[model samples]
Target chain A: MEQLVSALLIMIIGVLACAAYFYASNWLLDVLFPSKNKPADIVAKNIHITNTVRPWLFIGPALIALTFYLIYPVIESIRLSFLGRAGEEFVGFDNYAWLFSSDTFYQSFKNNMLWLIVVPTASTFFGLIIATMTDKIWWGNIAKSLIFMPMAISFIGASVIWKFIYDFRSGDDAQIGLLNAIVVFFGGEPQAWITVPFWNNLFLMIILIWIQTGFAMVILSAALRGIPSETIEAAVLDGANSIQIFFKIMVPQIWGTIAVVWTTITILVLKVFDIVLAMTNGQWGTQVLANEMFDWMFRGGGDFGRGAVVAIVIMVLVIPIMVWNIKDVNKEMEGR
Target chain B: MMAVSSSRSSLMWVVHITVFILVVMWTVPTAGLFISSIRDKDQLSVSGWWTALSVSEQRLVARSEHPDKQVFSSDGRYEIRGNILEHQDSSITKFGSSSLRPDEFDVGVVAQLKGGKTLQVLENGDYIYSSPEQWKGKRGKRIFYTANIPPRFTLDNYREVLTSEGLAKSFINSLAVTIPATIIPILMAAFAAYALAWMKFPGRALIIAAVVGLLVVPLQMSLIPLLKTYNLIGEFFGVGSKGYIGIWLAHTGFGLPLAIYLLRNYIAGLPGEIIESARVDGANDFEIFSKIILPLSFPALASFAIFQFLWVWNDLLIAMVFLGNNEEQLVLTGRLRELLGSRGGNWEILTASAFVTIIIPLCVFFGLQRYLVRGLLSGSVK
Candidate 1:
């Protein structure tokens, strides 16, 4: 209770402080250059000066935060990749050599690749299918909401939920988990789904697919709605079947949205950590790059060099997407 | 035409059935978690939550009254009578005197014991033990029974987690981290977004492009370097490296790119006349932004608020890095991860904790789904 009270106090103070900064800074600017009751030329100069400086005042805090937290970190992480464990000595490329030869890094890279290929494609596929199907049904909104419901669940919570489903028991005891029960009912032996070598990565991917499919669905559904009805009518009149109309006309038109969803989920897959950490914890060949980087960061009293190398690996993977995003935004800005 | 119509109707039915199956597949996992959270812990461990509404059978053992309590009856037999269920809401379907054959005799059927004693069990859990003379033993007989237990639900799991497992405290911590983290970014991003959108500034296009580029930079790139920086600052200031203030700033920084981008797009799209006319009325840029743009951009502000709230609330990696794992500062996700490690097999604790962690976000998602969906549509497609 006391902690909660302090937290509330901190929240109120922090917010008030932010409000005070903006208000105080603006007030100071107006006080320093009073445009009213001055010569016309002086007034014009004061207004121009305020206009020039006011924009800086507005953007100052945000710029400091971004540079300190994000931009600086990217640069520092690169420099640290060349240093030693404690970052005291400069060991050139030793961490990179260790990362390249390490079998676990290869395993994590392989698994991350699998995730990159599977999660986005599967999520986009399911999302497009559900969006198209739900658009036709009367109860589609409810179905859409139900499917999207998992998006609210944290990765740890989702891990717990999936872990329960994948639980296993030896001997003749009843199979309490849903998956094992089904397997047992089908006269098959129950297997620990998350412990299997290659198959376990797929099992881990399923959780992400489940959470992200709804995102794909919502975006694609809107894109589908944006498609002109005349195209679909044209296809129907020309004797194209429903599947043909969907694949030929609708899918082709909404291809850009599909790519967007795919890239978004792909970027998310590159940063996947909590799910892997909670379930299997890089054990059983389920290691991914993000989790691997996290393990290196704090493993055995921390190794900043190796950790930065892994982060650089993740950053390298994301460069293409970053460039693509900047180009897309530039185009949009140009159009505007 | 008639054949095509018939086939079209059939296809529609196929779509409905497929969608129905997909919905059930998506919803059942969460529904199962909720059901298991409320189920009796013993039953929850023994049976799947899908069978929560059905009668479950279990092998259980109970002791009869001491033989010394046997007394002479009107039928000329020493007898002992009692209910083996001890007021439990279950019925015995079968019973035996030995562990080897626990369900040896059907309910209401008499089974012969050693020394010419007999025992009869009834479905309602009543048992009668009788002998030709007096039964002799230092302790009561061990009677094993197979019980048919009805479905049971309770709030005990939730109560236990809330009170004992430190979830209540973590819930408060999550709120503390989330509220400030959500609000600070919105304020900072809104100011910057307004400047970029309305106010003419040097290098505005460059800053906008930087924000866009930062949007997809993997957060893994930021963790280690930031940790070192925070440690340095902590040493310099004589404060701990990890705390709510550190985490709130981290979340605000990470969330700012999307917040600025979304808000900038919305604010830029506002009719230019509002700001122009206000400027012509001799209002300063600050007054124009505070009075006109802020009110007009409520929808955009709302969307970003929901996004940041959910992201901060659901984040575990950021919390694990920026905040300490001690009980005083652990947020719900961190707490849930700890519980997963410490009590992996204890579903009672896990389901309840997981539910507690997700309930708030679920409520927020459902309650503000309109803004959430709107935000996603604009953020992604545009």
Candidate 2:
């Protein structure tokens, strides 16, 4: 309780301090210029000076934060990837060599590739299908909300939920887990889902897909709504069936939104960590790049070189999607 | 029209059935967790939550009253009469006097016992034992029964987790981290977004492009370098590297690009006449921003607030890196992950803790769903 009180105090003070900086800086600018009582010539000069200075004032804090947090780190991480474990000695290409030979790294790379292939495609497909289906029903909004609900759950929490479902109990004791119970009811042997090699990665991917499908659905649902009714009506007049209209008239127009959803999920998959950390901590062949990087960070009391390499690996995987996103935004800006 | 109507009905039915199945599949997992969290812990491990409303068959053993409680009837017979479920709350479906055959006798039937004694067990748990001789024993006879127990629910699991598991403290920590992290980014990003949208600057286009590009740079790239920098700065300042302030700044920095991009797009599309009129009225840029633009951009501000709030509240990796794992600073997600490790098999604790961790976000998601969907549509669908 004392901690909670202190936390609230800190929050209030921090917020107030931020507001004060903006307010105080603006006030100081006004005081220094004092355009209220000056002559017309001096007032015009003051206004021009403030206009030039104010834009920087507005953008200065954001710029400082971005450079300090993101830009500097990207450069530093690249440099650190070439350094030794303690970062006191210079090493060239050795960490990459080690990464290539390590079995766990290989497994992580393989599993991440599987995730990259499966999660985005599955999420986007399910999202598009559900969005299209729900748009026609009366309780569409409720159904959409139910399916979208998983987005609010944290990855760790989702892991616990899925882990419970995949729980395996041995012997004649009735299966407590939902999956095992169904398997037992059908006279099949229950398996430990997360411990299975090669296939466990897909089981882990299912959690992410469950959580992200809603994001795709929400975006695509809007895009689906944005399609012009005239196209559908024209298709109808030509005696096009529902499937034909949906595939030919509707999907082709929403391809851009689909690409956006797919790329977004792909980027997210590259940074997947908490689910793996909570579920298996990369044990039993379920290792992914993000969790592997995290393990290297704390393994044997921290190894910055190997960890930075893994981070760079993740960044490399994400660069294509990042480039694609920037180009899409630039195109939109040009159109605007 | 007639043919179209006929086929459309069939299509609609198919849509309804398919959607219903999908909805059930999606909702049942969460519903199972929720139901299991409130259930009797013993019952939870034995049955699925879908059967939570039905009667569950359980094997139980009950001891009858001690032989000392026997009474002498006027007919000179020693008898013992008592309820088999004296303190329990279940109906007996079958009863037996032996362990091997627990359900040997049907309820309300008399069973012949040793030495010509008779025992009767009833559905309501009442039992009678009579013999034509004095009863002398220290303990009563053990009776085995098969019971059809009704569904039971309790708030004890929630209480246990909240009181003993430290989730309540973590809940506050999450709020502390989330509120400032959510608010600071909005303030910083709104100003930058306003400048990018309305002001004339030489490098405005480049800055806008940078913000969009940074939107997808994997956060993994930032963690290592930032950790080193933070350690150095903390050592120089003689303070710990992990604290609420550091995390708030980290989240603000990470969240800024999206916040700025989303808010910039919204602000730039606003009618230019409002700012122009304010300018013509001799108001300066600051005046126009706080007074005119801020009020006009409430919807955008609200939408971004919900997104940032949810993201920060749901984040675990950032918390683990930037904040300490002690009780004073562990956020809900961190606490939950710890619980997953320490209390892995105890679903009673796990379910309740997981439910507590997610309940706030679920509420926020349902409550502000309009703004959330609107934000997603504008932020990505463009």
Candidate 3:
């Protein structure tokens, strides 16, 4: 309790310090410039100085934090990838060589590719289906909220929930897990679902798909609603069936939002760590890039070089999406 | 047209059925977790939560009172009589004397024992033992029975986990990390977002593009480097490398891009006239930001707050890297992962702890779902 109190106090102080910086620095800028009281030429010069300096003052703290936390780390990680385990001595391409030759890296890379292909496509497909179905129902909001509830659950929490579903019992013991119970009910052999080698990767991906489908649903639902009504009406008048209207008219219009949702879930699938860490921990052939990177960072003492190499793999995969996002934003800015 | 109308009606039925199935599919897993958390641990382990309301048969054992409590009846026979279940509300269905065949006899049957002894069991869990000579033993006979136990539910699992599993402390730790991490980023990002939005800056477009690019930079890229830097800073400051302050700062830095991006879009959309007139009224940029723009941008701030709050609260990777895994600093997710590793089979502990971990976010998700959905739409669709 005392610790909590002290932490809260520190938080308040930190927030207050941030507020004071913004306030005091802006005040200091005005005092230094004296834009209102100076002679005409001097006033113009001071105004220009304040305008140029004030924007920096507003952005300075954020810039410093971003550079320290993000930009510098990206550069440092590249450098660390070239160094040895302790990161003190340079090892050139040794880390990359080991990474390329290791079976685990290949396994992780393959699993990551599989996840990238399956999770986003599955989530977006389900999201579009649910969005279309729920739009016509009166209780649609309630259904959407229920489906979306998993979005709030942490990946680890979702893992626990799904683990319970995939639980297995050997012999004649009653199958307490829902999946095995259904399997037994259908007169089939109940298998330990997550320990099934190559197939277990799909089980892990299901957890992510379950959590992310709601995000896709919410975004795609909004996009579906934003579709102009006249096009659908015109399709109906032209003897286009409901499915035809959905495919030919509505889908093409919201293709942009669908791509957005797809990429968003794709990025998420790349960074998925907690689910694999909690559920399988890269065991049972469920290894992925993010969890593998984490494993190397602390597996035996620490391997900075190997960890950074794996991180760079994930970063390389994200560059395309990153470039695409920047282009999208640049286009938006130009429009503005 | 008439045939199309009929087909459409049938399609509506299909939609309703499909939606119903989907909703159940999505909700049952969480609902199962909740139900299992409240169920009796014994029943929860042996049976699915779907059978939580049904009578579950269990094999149980009881011993009669010690032979010292035996009495000589009027018929000149020694007997020991007792209720096996004591005060439980279960009925015995079968009884036996050995572990190999625990259901060897019917509830009302009499089984003859060696040396002129007899035993009889009843459905009400009452058993009788009689001997022609005397029952001379320190312990009574063991009676095994299959009882039909009705469904039971309790808060004992929750109580045990909250008090014994260190979750209560981790809950506080999570709040400590989350609340400030949520607030500080919003405060810093609001200023940066405003400058990028309303203020005429030379590099605004370039910075906006950078924020967008950084949004997708995998956190894996930052963990190793940041860990080294944090250790150095901690050495210089003479504090541990992992602490609440370090984690709060890390979360703030990580969450700033999205906060800035979301808030910039929203703040940039505010009417030019409002800010122009405010500026024309001699209101300084700080004054305008704190007074007019801040209050007006409440929705955007709220949207970002919920996002950051959920992100920081649910985060395990950042917490694991920045805060370390010491008990004093473990967040709920980390604690839960540990519980999963240690008590992999103890569903009672896992379910209850998971419920405790997820309940707060569930409440926030339901209560402020409007803002969350709006945030998602703006963050992605825009």
What tens-digit string does per-residue lDDT give for candidate 1 at B1-382? 8998899899999999999999999998999999999999989999999999999998989988998788899989999888889547898899999999999999999899888889999999888988898878798888899999999999999999998999999999999999999999999999999999988888999999999999988899999999999999999999999987899899989999999999999999999998999999999999999999999999999999998999999999999999998988999999999999999899999999999999999999999999999999889987
Candidate 1 stretches with Cα past 4 Å from truth are B65-81, B115-118, B128-141
Q: What TM-score fits each model?
A: 0.97, 0.93, 0.97
Indicate the worst ten consecutive residues by lDDT in candidate 1 chain A: A11-20
What is the per-residue lDDT of model 3 for residues A89-179, given as tens digits with 9 covering 90 to 100?
9999999999999999999999999999999999999999999999999999999999999999998899999999999999888999999
Clashes of each: 0, 0, 0
Candidate 1 on A179-222: residue-level lDDT in tens? 99999999999988999989999989999999999999999999
Clashes of 2: 0
Better of 1 and 2 by DockQ: 1
Q: In candidate 3, how many Å is residue B208 off? A: 1.3
- Candidate 3 residues lying further than 4 Å off, grouped into runs, are A30-47, B133-140
What docking grade applies to model 3?
medium
**Residue B137 lDDT (model 3):** 73
Candidate 2 global CA lDDT score: 0.91
The residue pairs found clashing in candidate 3 are: none
Q: Could you give me the TM-score of model 2 versus the true structure?
A: 0.93
